[model samples]
Target: MSEVEKRYLAAKERYAKIGVDTDEALKKLQEVKISMHCWQGDDVKGFLNPDGELTGGIMATGNYPGAAHTPEQLRSDLEKAFAMIPGKHKVNLHAIYVDTDEKVDLNTIEPKHFSKWVDWAKEQGLGLDFNPTFFSHPMFKDNYTLASPDKEVRDFWIEHGKRSRKIAEYFGKELGQTCINNFWMPDGMKDNPIDRLSPRKRLMEALDEIFEEKLDENYTQEAVESKLFGLGAEAYTVGSHEFYMGYGLTRDKLICLDAGHFHPTEFISNKLSSLALFSKGVMLHVSRPVRWDSDHVVLMDDELTEIGRELVRNDLLPITNIGLDFFDATINRIAAWVVGTRNTQKALLKAFLEPTDDLKKIELENDFTTRMVLTEELKDFPFGDIWNQFCELNGVPVGLDWLKEVREYEKNVLLNR
Candidate 1:
């Protein structure tokens, strides 16, 4: 047997001793598709304005060489990233990334603007997800759109939101998978606003107007994301957690929980179970936040593992949509994709390999000692072996082998750009 097969066999036997079937874990994990956000490839500089400055308190730091400057380049970079990641996954898109020659603003964007992406997705056998670019445009005047008191500003955004759903529906119909069109607005105040309720109310009314037309749930799922604070909007945010939580519950919409959007002390992992109880479904924007909402590349950190554990242990996977949302222009963009995506997959695999039933049984029986012991022991398990085996199974380069190819590509493809 090969080294990978041999290691996997040994690891499988070890896990089986704890009543964990590594094979079953791997099988389940293979089917879980993580939506790889495309903005990371181009530093959130969508095709709409490749050279424009980021508004909405959004920033993609670093002058990383070879940032995608066009749709074809972005697609090529995505393809390169996908090759390194095991298991088929979806590509997440922002409306600003629309690939078309026609002159169309956000208010007029249609599904045809993204037909090229749909065609490429079909060719790659991948699914598609979408987000409306509510920030960085002139219409987003005074750090507001939907919540803006000006009816014209609100009307412009409402139309964009409407068209975004149509495009998402088209993606679902063409790709044969539900497209999660998430909405996140950078509508807030730099200083503490005296009247937060009014803006929130306006946002609610605008959202209601946008969702008035019901589309088939099979084709599209809408999610609203909440942010704590942003660069300019450090004092107050209209779409606070409470606001989106109540809105999502009342409207039966998917609530997107972005890891970096919360305070450092707050954990989205702990909120998943609660949301599963009330909301129709949940969407995860898995990211890494250092001190502030700095969108660092994801790592196989403790919190990440806990998020994975919560999903698996509570059986929330079926009701949750997973997606990555971080941009680090400091390093190689393609490597950023591979690292973040692979780490996320690894987190899920670790959770899947846990003897969840046994742990729960012990805990329920008041056998705290055993539960703690097993959980700690799992930290030392042959997880790397299983990860390597997974990579081999999926025909992707194993371990650091993929890094070599990334470097070669940087030298050949990235440097030229």
Candidate 2:
């Protein structure tokens, strides 16, 4: 037998000796809570009525609509959105963008708007989340990976990072909600190799700045306490893909793996989850993968079921929050809300039913081949069936037939590529 096969057999023997109960493992998985990153555009579906004065609302269909509003409009919209969500479904707000054409100014925009949202969230009991990127601006079109040798481009990126730190600090103090900065830089190419080292350096430098701001001595006197900052990176970006050796992997940051983002690259989602668990990050961005683009559609049967099982085995946090990172102009706002929420709920239920110990053992095993096989198995599980099984096991009422509805909606709405 080959060395890898021998290692796998040895690992399996060790696990067998310990003997995990699948039923008990499934129970533990059920305890994990799920949440979603809220966007203004997502609320326009018919489930919740739009407060006309506010930019968006939860529609009857259960999805939210993207609302690209001015600062003033955003404040009002957030107030309404918080009031609409049921206490059972956790709501995570997206990074506050300045405008459609520009990235939101953290210093100015977050302080005013974020403070307002915090107060409103407190009243409603909701959490906030954000994505960290400088891509929205025209200047960052070249890169925010921080490798630009050009002084002007580098300076712009630096300013953006500084803004992100200030914003994180403000949210930490005012909201007490952990600020999750999802860092996905449009800064690399598959063919052309750039100064690969600089991007990582720049990312670490920006993180250090944020850390320093949180530790600033001046903030000790504030009446309100700040939230701890958590950082998450997209599955793949410009330069090197996947977790590479020698790259400084800090414990402070969590790896945010998007399901749809990795499908085309053959980057194994379950293995990525294990790496994130090994490194220790807060949560994962659970969404469906398609083509090269993040279809951001609802969870597929095969994709998320496997991820959910792996999460349980690895003891990774399940959908601490969900991000419907999709763009669809055709679907009426109401349909979007229903679709997003339904898909998220379905995915979470399936993941919650997975055997936790099985996942945990796979994660703890030293054999790389066994881990790889486990990850592959997880990616192929029947997630939709698992979700139904979970609902039946828990004796909870399954409210909507979202898969059928979404299929119909996609036929009419999803734009041709």
Candidate 3:
């Protein structure tokens, strides 16, 4: 037998001895569908206007050459990124990425504005997710949208939210899969506000208006995301975690938990079980944080592994909506996508390799000492071998071979621009 076949057999025996079906684990891992963010390729600039500079708190650092400048280029770059990524996936888009002949006001945007995206996704056999762009416009210069005290501003953003939902419905109908429409606004004060309650009250009123006209839930899922702070919004975020969590539970909406948006010591793994208790599904934006809400590319770290473990052990994969939300312009954009996405899969696979059934039984029996030792010992198993077999089965490059492939793309395609 070949080397890969032999290694997989050996690893399979080891996993089987621990009560894990290696083949079943690999199959389940393949069933995971992660939505890759399109903003990463273009650094969140989208195609709103060629001259539109980065606004809001989100900014991708570095003068990386050949960042996508147009819709066609962005889609082309995504094709390359998707090729190296192992699993079939969806591409996340902000409304600003709409392909149109002229600047379309946010409130007036139609599904026609995104027809090209739908056509492309159909052609590529991928699904699409959407976000309402609440920043970078002149109206939001005060750092407010839905939560603004001004009635005119709130009404305009409410219309935009409605339009975004319509477009998400279109995506779902056209692609035959539900599209997740996420809404996040950068509304807060630089310093302590004298009237925080008023803004939040206005926000609730506006949201009530936004969701008053409901679309079919099967075609469109709405997610509300909260942030602790942004560049200027240091004192308080209008849509704090508490705010969205309560809103989500009360309204039966999905709540998004961004890893980088919480306190440094807080981890999402610990929150999964609690989240699963209420919401039908939770939206996860997997990004690494370095001290603050700095959306760094995700790595295969302990916290990430634990997040994966929680999902698998709790049987929450069916209810966990996973997506990547980091943009690092300093490196080759394609490589960043590959590394972040592949590392996420690696974490999930590591979780799959664990003998969770056995570990949990031991824990229930109150044999804490043995449980701890087995947990630690399982880490040194031939996980790498199993991972290599997974890549082989999926028809992707094994180990570090993809590094050379991405370098070639950078030289021939990325630097050409």
Candidate 4:
């Protein structure tokens, strides 16, 4: 047997001793899902590089006009591109606006065309996801936090949500797909901090409206069975602003934690477990951090690998969706997707395979003592070995030599001390 197979066997034995079946464990490990946000002009060939190396294309952000064609033509092109992405990767269609103003609009495509697009996506064997941004419309310049002190800006934000909610409702009703409303507010402090809490409240209120309107109310004929139900919104927000909105509104809305969005000061694994504890489904956007910026780079950093693994092992929640949020102009978007997807899978596999029921138990306890124990126990774990094992499991042909090169590059840039 190969060295990796031998190590996996030993690890399997250790897990079996702890009463965990390795085959079942491996199946759980494989269940992790990875997805990406689709841009306006995604070049399929560019994303899936001919060379084995997971590097292709560049990252550019901003309003690019849809290809000069009818909605039907664009839909056709997108269908073809969707088919090219490997079956394993999930594609998130970016903002579909309603009006010419790029800021806030529902999908501009006609209702029939919109339904056709969703049907096409289903036909292509792909899942759908979305990130709601304020920049799509001209009016949302100040931002989407509805209670902004500036009356005009606040109104604009509210109006934006009202319209966006309608669009989300259409999709929910027609497509039978739940919109993962990823709300990332660009309205942070400038010089003096802004009292923008009210805007956020208004946004949530708007979402509650959408949820109420879209859900179905059931009435039973048997004597007395009356029920009113509303379509639910998967309200995913970042940890940075967790304090602004308490658990009440957020509790109902699914809380998704982005590994890169947390400040360096926060404990990510604990935060993830906390979200899981709420019994709200967990969605992850995995990326390496670079100081304050959400680098969206694939999982090459060792510290993040360790934290990500702990989240998986402790929570007992399957990674419902994994997304790569990287932006580099040179790398093909699809190639970036591949690297990010595989790297995340690697990190997850390593965590899934860790041989310690004690560690899992401690995480479940969610107390200070267990936290301290995990902090100390995982301090000296070999992160790179996990990365290597993941590569082995996935049949990644890249060898240790490439990793060594990356290490050397990191040493030159980050070490120097």
Worst 10 residues of 3 by lDDT: 48-57
Candidates' RMSD to native: 0.7, 11.8, 1.1, 11.2
Query: Which residue runs does candidate 4 get wrong by more than 4 Å?
Result: 1-22, 40-89, 96-113, 143-145, 149-179, 194-240, 243-251, 318-321, 358-417
lDDT of 2 by residue, 23-141 (tens): 44345545443445444343321111223311110112333333433444444433332222222334444444333333344233444545655565566555545554434344543
Q: Lowest-scoring 10 consecutive residues by lDDT in candidate 2?
A: 221-230
Candidate 3 per-residue lDDT, tens place, 67-184, comes to 9989998999888887877778899999999999966988889999999999999999899999999987877858889988788898899999999999999999999988998889
Model 3 lDDT on a 0 to 1 scale: 0.88
Q: TM-score of each candidate?
A: 0.99, 0.60, 0.98, 0.62
On TM-score, the leading prediction is 1
Q: Tens digits of per-residue lDDT for model 4 on 276-321?
A: 6663455555655555433455755675576656666665455344
lDDT of each: 0.94, 0.43, 0.88, 0.45
lDDT score, candidate 4: 0.45
Q: Ten consecutive residues with minimal summed lDDT in candidate 1?
A: 48-57
Which prediction has the highest lDDT against the true structure?
Answer: 1
By TM-score, rank the candidates, best first. Answer: 1, 3, 4, 2
Ranking by lDDT: 1, 3, 4, 2
